[model samples]
Every structure is written in C-alpha cells, then in structure tokens.
Target: MEAKLYDGPMIDAHQHFWQPQINPHPWLAPDVLIPFRYGDYSAIKREYLPPDYLKDATPKHNVVATVYVDAEWDPKDPMGETKYIHTVAEKYGMPNAVVAQAWLHADDVEAVLKAQSQYPLVRSVRHKPAGALSPAEAQSGIRTLMSDEKWRQGYALLAKFGLNFDLQTPWWNLHEAKRLALDFPDTLIILNHTGLPYDRSAEGLKEWHKAMSLLSDIPNIVVKISGIGLPDKKWDINDNRWIVQETVQIFGTDRAMFASNFPVDSLCGDLETIFTGFKEAVKDYSPEDQHKLFFANAKKYYKMKI
Candidate 1:
C-alpha cells in the first residue's frame, strides 16, 4: 500500500547547517578526507546554510522547526558552532533548537558544558564517544568506551547543567550504552542514526537487532531513525524500511523520531526521498503514532519551542 503523504508540522529531530568558509569544519576541509558512510561527500562540502536547507525541505515537507546537530567544527573553538547557529536562527527563523558540540573527555569539559548551557537555543550536546571498530575489538573493551571514568565524569555533568546527550556510536557498542544509561538515569540519551546499523548482511542485521533490543530495555534512552543510507546505493525504501520499522518497534513510537540528517544524507538522496520513505515505512500505524514518530517525539526530546 502506498503511504499517504503527511502534511502536518514536523520538528526535524536531527540535521545540520554549516558554513565551512566562515567557520572551519576540519572534516569538510579541502585536504581532509575522512572515511565517511556515504563514500565521497565532496558533493556537500560547500556552505549549506539555512537557505540551502529550506530550499531542499520546504514545499516538500512542512518542516515547522529543526534541531541543529553540531557539524564537527574546529575543536579548538568548540563554542563557535553554537554561536554561528544562533546567528542563522535569528536571521532565518528556523532551527528552533541547537545540539551544540562538547568533547566529553576533554580537559575543559566542565567549563564547556557550563558555557553551552547558557545558550537558550542549546538543548543537548553531542560528543561521539570513542568505541571499538568491530565486535571482536569490543570484546576486549576499549578504554574510551562510555564506561571510562573520565568520560563518565564528564557525562555526569550533563544532569547538573540541564542538558541531554546525543550519542552516535555503532550498534555493537550498545551494551556499553545500556550501562551508561543505567548509571546516569537522569540524563536523557538520544541515540543517533538508529545506532548506525551499517552492515546489511544477514549476520550483521542479527547482531544489530540484538544490540538494539538490549538498549531498548533502558528507559532513559531514545533514538532518531535517520542516516541508514549505504555508501554506493541510492536511498530506496526497500533497503531501509525494515531498519526504520524495527527501530520503532524496539523503541516504541514515543521514543523514536524521524530526522533528515541532511546535507550529509543528501549524499544518498534528496530530503523528499528520505522523509517520504520514513512516512511510507510506518504508514500502517495510526495517525497519532505517525505524528509522534515524525513530529511530536522530536519536539519533546529536544525541548523544541515550536
């Protein structure tokens, strides 16, 4: 059955806007080529400000508001990204919320968290915690895992500042995530990219499913169902439907949200293709549940003032 298009207001739970020319994003630098999920991201290395994003989203989707996730800005000046986003929001009237950057284990973590909390638009912070490369490597336990005392020391500070954490680790490290959530029950942990289920093999999916199920048992954690695109493939519904549906099934409608992960995700497909695929994937659900998945959950999770 073809899913009807949703015309309701949406709060993009996760997306980014960057001006690499003005503010330095090392990853987006001309010389720096990091291993990316979407292969050659050269197509998106240019300045993608609010106007660029709205051109891709508006008229196609009713995008009432958006939450700006931090693009890796120059770490030497962590607060620079948040300040720039505030200016964009003031000028553009979108990105009603901001997920600023913070290095959880950095020497200046405490000062950074305190400063980030001061911004009215800042609601959450993302510090992609260090994790193992593969399940085999994870078995021995990496020192920088969320379990690390120094990292936990920094993570524990989130509650004090009334901030949430946006976690972007692979599915294999969710066991570590579960423990972190249990220990710090007060801090709301928003899992990015559906726990990053990149490996699509039968065995890979089984592992991903097991990891997702394990993490779902924790009440403090929620998930954003975005960034499921593969390197060399187009963003087709057939390839991503199961991952989206299974995530909502595991985390429940209230705990899972749909996001664009745009500019970066644009490397795979257009915004219309991604959001339409999301609407179609869960069209079997009731309207209320659909609304929660696409809109309400994001607003609530990010404390978006929409």
Candidate 2:
C-alpha cells in the first residue's frame, strides 16, 4: 500500500538554484556551519545550477519544467539569483518559472519588487517571515515577523506587480497566513513544504494536520507537497505516503502539486528515490489525478508556459 507505480512527466513546482561560488550564501559557507532545522545540511553546501539540477532530475523523473524557488543568497543583492536563473532558463530550457525574493520590510521594497517583476520568467516572490513560538526556536535564528506594518506594506506591493507569493514559514503561523490570504483575496499564496510540519511526533503531526486543514479552507492558498523529511532527515515511504495522501485529500488534486525540493531533499536520498517515493505514495489515484499532482497543477500554479 505504501508504494505504487506512477509514470508521469512532472512539472516540478518547487526547487532551488544557487551558485555559492560567485554569490555568497552565508548559510552554505562550509566553516561557519550551524545546526539548521532540517538537520545536518552540510552535504548541499556546494554550487547547484540548472545543469547540475538537470543531471539529477532527468533520465529518471522526466522533469519537463521546474519552478525555481528562492534560495537565501546574499541579502545585499536580491536580484542576483533571478539574473542567474534567467541565464540558465535561456540555455537549458528548464526553470520556466522563477519565484524571486524581496524583503517585505525593506524601505526599497517596491524598487526591489519592480526589478524582480521585470524579469519575464519571474512569477512570484519569496520572503520567508520569522515567527517562532518558542525561545529555542527564536534562538535558532528563525524569525517570526509576519505582523509588522512595514512588512504588510511590502506584501501589498506584489499585487501591484501582478506576482504571487511563495510562503515558507513554520506551521504554527498558518493561522496568520490564513489571515493574510483573506486580506489579499486576489493574490495567490503558495504554501511551501506541506506547511513544514517539522515535528514528526504523533502530537506534532496532529497539530500539523490541523493547521493545514485550516489553511486549506482559504481558496487562494495551494500546498506544495515536499520536505516530508525536513523535521527529521530520515526518509520512509509509508510516512511520506501518509503526508502526501493527507495533503491531496485536504486540498484536492487541483490545489496540490509535487515538488522535488531537490538538493534540500537530496540530503535524504537521490532524485529518483525521492520522486519514486512521491509517485508510489499516490499510485492508487487515477491517471488524471496523478497528472494533476505531478504536472498540470504546477504548470497552472506557477503560470509556466511550458
């Protein structure tokens, strides 16, 4: 029951591209390593571009188009990643869509959003707000910054540019996320990594399920089913299957799509193994439903022409 056969071309709705060599990602720097929430992420500290991504994604999963989610790069040059992905998209014909980053609280937020919006492939923006509930979580260097007026002002700019939002935050904050979704009814909100149910305990998962259910009630919100192993870096098909099935059940095929999360998930297993687990998890669904989860939904959600 945990594994099922699924063969479909995927439109990877979520993934990332970063060149640590030319651009500085302080988190990815080798010597200054710290414990990340995802646990022992040192394995992915090197440069990863479309070529490397294609090498890992193709001949196995049949990734026709992928959407590049923002990788935390040097904060000083927020548009750098967009420029880099443009080159990759032009050369490889992959990453047909890009979700660039812009600090929602910055004084020049509009200027940044405008610059990012000018890029043809950019369809959304990702500026993960920090809203940790516990002192430990706060000390972990994660922020809980959603309610700020300045940030909301910046969030308002997305509608002006006609860009959607890629939201990556802890699950505890989904209630606030729901409010934001309501406030901007016209703006599309894509929730990253299955609400990031970082806690795998029975109680933790139960809490995660509750939060996701509440967020799913909002028509503007869509869930990206990936990062099942994030809270704990171990992988199990059955556990992942339950998360995948529960997400699709709650949001339905039209509102849910699968993403590789690639190098981040590469910490758990190879690309084939990761996507195979996803395919197997949804094997009982109809071919059309599987196509929606694996391909069509991403194309629609990301607004990718390919």
Candidate 3:
C-alpha cells in the first residue's frame, strides 16, 4: 500500500540548509555544538538537503512540506541565498516560505523589504543577533545602529512590509525580548528555538520559567518548539520534556508551533527522531490541539497558503 501523508498540510515551518564543504562557514562553534556531544559533528556528514531529509526522516511522521528559514548570512546585500532557495522551493513547488534577514538599520530596512518582495516565500525577517555565541562576520548593524527613534522607524517598516520578525537569540534575553515584542504589537514575532533557554543550573531553570512566563503575556509573541539540540546533556533534543511542557503551559497550542528545525537540528537527531519526540510529547493533547501544534498553528502564524 502507498503511504499516506498527513491529512492537512504537515508544514514544518522551521528548517535550514547549508553545505559546509561548499559554504565552509562556521555558523556556530563546534566546541559548543550539541551534536558533537551526541556524536561526532563531522560524522553527521556535510550539509543537508531534501534527499538527506528523506533518508533520515520517515514519512509516517507526517511532513507533507516545509517552509525554509534562511540559514546563511543575508549577504553583504539582501539577495544571496534568497534567490537560491527560492529557485529550489519553486522548482518542486514547495510551500517554502523563507524568513529573510533584514538588518533594522535606519531607513535601509525599506530596501530590505523591497528585496524580499522579489521572492514569493520571503515572508518574514531575521536579523542575526550582533553578539550571540559566535563572533564571525559583522551583523547587519540594523538593530544596534538604529537608535530608539531608528528602532521605532524600523519597526514600522517591518509592519509595512507585512513581515513577521524571527527572534534568534539565547532565551536568556527574554526580559529585553519581552519589551521588544510588546513594543511592536503589530509585527507578529516568532521566537526561535524556544528562545534558546539556557536552563542547565537550578537558577538557570528557575529564571527561564519566570522570563518565559513574562514573555508569554505579550500577544504578538509566539514560541517555536524547535532547535532543542543542545550539546548540554540536560537539554538534548531527545530530552525535550520540560521545554515542550512549559511551552504548552505558557503559550498553549494557539500561540505555539512545532518545527523540524532540521539540518541544523540534524546536528541532534534525524528528522524522524525529532518528529517522534514532538508527537510523543503532544500525543495526549486533543487532535484539534495536536493539529495546531504540528500544522494548523504554523499556517495561521505565518499566514501560509496551505
């Protein structure tokens, strides 16, 4: 018998792609990488594409399609991998909505949006945080370059673009992050990697809950149940009980969505393993709720055509 995919569009809204051999970019430090602890990061192989996806992940887990989030630098200009992924997604007719990076510097964001409009799936914005865990290329300088007035100006530009803001910082910054989301209620903010909570110690865990709870109240903020592959044994992708449960309690299915967060997450488990963990956590949830976590909510959040 032929396998049947998920009934509705099983859209994995958050996944990435990069060829280390071809790209040779150290997106993150290998020392701090979670995949290295689980197994050799090099053993995982170089770059991940759809074929790698099929080999590693099972269809029964139900991923009808995916939306590609930008995985590389936004180019010195706005149009680097933007054109490449668009070509790939368009060829297979993948739903393939992309979260393009737009530095929030001054009125230049308007130029970023104009560049985004060139592609159909360029539906959102992600500015690589200036000083996250890595220190490689200079960031867009949009966020820091913009003063309060500049930020206020850039915020309106993002809204005018009808773009969602993808926040890709360590979850520890939730306090400051909360303010950013609340300040821009009009811009739908998707928190990446569950805000990357650094909840290893008792205090870290305690603070994580409090910070997350505060952010939950912000109506514009939604949490992504993705990128749980921490090198730290405590927060490994296979062990996502606390992150999953806490997220459900704080954001609920209505404001939360599950993501493959693959290739990057491929650093942890295969796509199927990630989905197995995802479905297992939410299995007790009602079908309606589970549907929301897996598919519906992402569609609604990103305004996806599916």
Candidate 4:
C-alpha cells in the first residue's frame, strides 16, 4: 500500500523572493496591457521577501526550509546575483540553504566561480532558461560559446567550485543540457520545470517526454517538477497537476523532485494551493518515493544540509 504523503521532511528545493520595489528584480519583463499581465509575479505585487519568504512560503508548502534560488539580479550588474542572494540568505538565515546565479558568458567562468568565494550558503548556480529557442538552436549558441575554449574551461571551474547548475530552461533546451552533462559528469545539474515547452494542447508533449527520458540517462542530472504562469495554458498548480504527473512518469521519483518556484509561480496560486496541488499530484506514489520527490531529492541535489 502506498503511504500518505504529508509534506514530508521537505526543504523547498526551489523558491524565489524578490521585490522590484524593496529589493533587486530588474528582469521582470512586464506585459501590463496584454490579455493578462505576464512575467515575474513579483511585479504584480511585492514578493519573495521577508514577510513572504519567511512567513508565508515557510508555512504554506509545509516547508521545513527553503533553498533560495538567485533571482537573476540583472545580468549586467557588477555585483552579480550571487552576492545579492548571499546577503538575503545571510540576513534571514533562510533554510540554511541557497542557490546563487553564476550566469557566466561561457568565457568569464573562473571569475564567476571565484566571485562567490566567501558566501558559504551559496550552494548552486542557475543558467537561465533559453526557452524561446529550440534545443538545436540553443545548442548551436551554447556550443559557439563553449567552443571558445575559454568556455569549455569554465565548465571545469564550475565543477571545481563545488557548485550545482540549475537549468531554468524549457523542453527544447534538453539536448544541450544532456551535452553539458556529458561534458561535466561530476557537476550536479538540475532541470527546472520538467523542461517547459509550448504546451497548450500537448502539442509537443510527446516530444518533450522523449527528451526528458533522454535527459534522465545522465545520472548526475535531476529534474525539478515546478514552474507556473508559463505559456500554453494552465492558470495554477491545481489546474496543472496532469502535466506534473505526466512529467513524473517520464523522469520517475528518484530523478524528479517538487519545487514551488514561488512568487514566479505565485502568478498561478498561493503557496497553499501550490502545496495542495503537488501533494495531490504525487499522493499516489509509494511513501519512500514520495519522500524523495517532496524533500529528500532536493536535500541531496542542492546538498541542502536540512
């Protein structure tokens, strides 16, 4: 019998806290005049900060703790996103965990890794999703960057820095991800959102599923079953359970885990609804597997000491 899952020993492997007003969030590309405003739910309202990150996110997901992902504090900034996250994670003593952005140009990789030297909570780095482009196209771009010799050199540095790479990309980018995995087998690589694609009517879902299966072939890469307010349709996590469950079928329990991608995902549902939806989505799995999806996997991936 499958045991019930009650938000087990959970450390939210993914969650963001940013405030355009109070904190640094310059990448919030808004569409105020659209059918509905999009990009960065934090823009619609102040989010990902003390009251929300500490008070709401903690209780809502039944989160025993959280891994603070870098909010991409503008790629152009000299300070870089790592320091910003380091400051906040240190300020709140959040989750005793953190994931900062390395966002290297595939060339300045060493400088990027060395930049985060002091921040102990800085556990990982996110290379933002090249979602708009197809995997092949992105591969061309990434390879162009990697072929620079210096870029290939960067991969070694990231692996050396003891950092994890959270690929915040879409389904189309999976192939390139696999390439990265082959090149750096020792580095922990995570796929955020089961590889988001243009999913309105399962148009590319079958293809995406195949891509995910291929991605799982790389032992070091894990999948994050989270993302929201993305194009193709569902409004909230509750409405999106089918897709999440489908993703689990492809990635399986050991390779996949739950993440709230909060504030960003807040565009769809509050933390309660998010957790409720996730619980519903995975409730049918075995207790041990369920534990891995909701918590254990994240603890291991990000090396969260929680």
Whole-model lDDT values for every prediction: 0.90, 0.84, 0.68, 0.68
Q: What is candidate 2's TM-score against the reference?
A: 0.92
Best by TM-score: 1
Best-fitting candidate, scored by lDDT: 1
Residue-wise C-alpha lDDT for candidate 1, range 42-127, written one tens digit per residue: 88888888888889987979888999999999988989888989999999997899999998888899999999999989999999
Instruction: Tell me how candidate 4 scores on lDDT.
Output: 0.68
RMSD of model 4 against the true structure: 3.6
- Model 3: per-residue lDDT, tens digit, 1-306? 332223344778798665555543444334434433235555444666766665555556657667778765535655776876776676656545888867676457788777786677878888745443421111333232222556557766778778888877765455556777777778888888776764456676676677789877788999888877766242344467777888888998899988877766665566766777777776677777778888887888777776
Q: Give stretches of model 1 more than 4 Å off.
A: 1-3
Error of model 4, residue 266, in angstroms:
1.1
TM-score, every prediction: 0.97, 0.92, 0.82, 0.83
Residues 1-306, candidate 4, lDDT per residue (tens digit)?
A: 754656656777788766555555555544322342244343445545656755655554566767777776766653555566667667776645677666556456577677764467777777564334554665566533333455456656777788877776666666667887898888878777667745545656677777777875688888887774554344565557777887788777888888877766666656676777788878888888888888888887776765
**Model 4 misplaced regions, further than 4 Å:** 29-47, 58-60, 78-80, 129-150, 229-239
Clashing pairs counted in every model: 0, 5, 3, 1
Residue 120 of model 2: what lDDT?
A: 97
List the candidate numbers ranked by lDDT, top first: 1, 2, 3, 4
Which is the winner by TM-score between candidate 2 and candidate 4?
Answer: 2
Please list the Cα RMSD from the true structure of every candidate, rounded to 1 decimal place: 1.4, 3.0, 5.8, 3.6
Model 3, position 154, has a per-residue lDDT of: 72
Q: What ranges in model 2 sit over 4 Å off?
A: 1-4, 133-143, 230-233
The TM-score measured for candidate 4 stands at 0.83
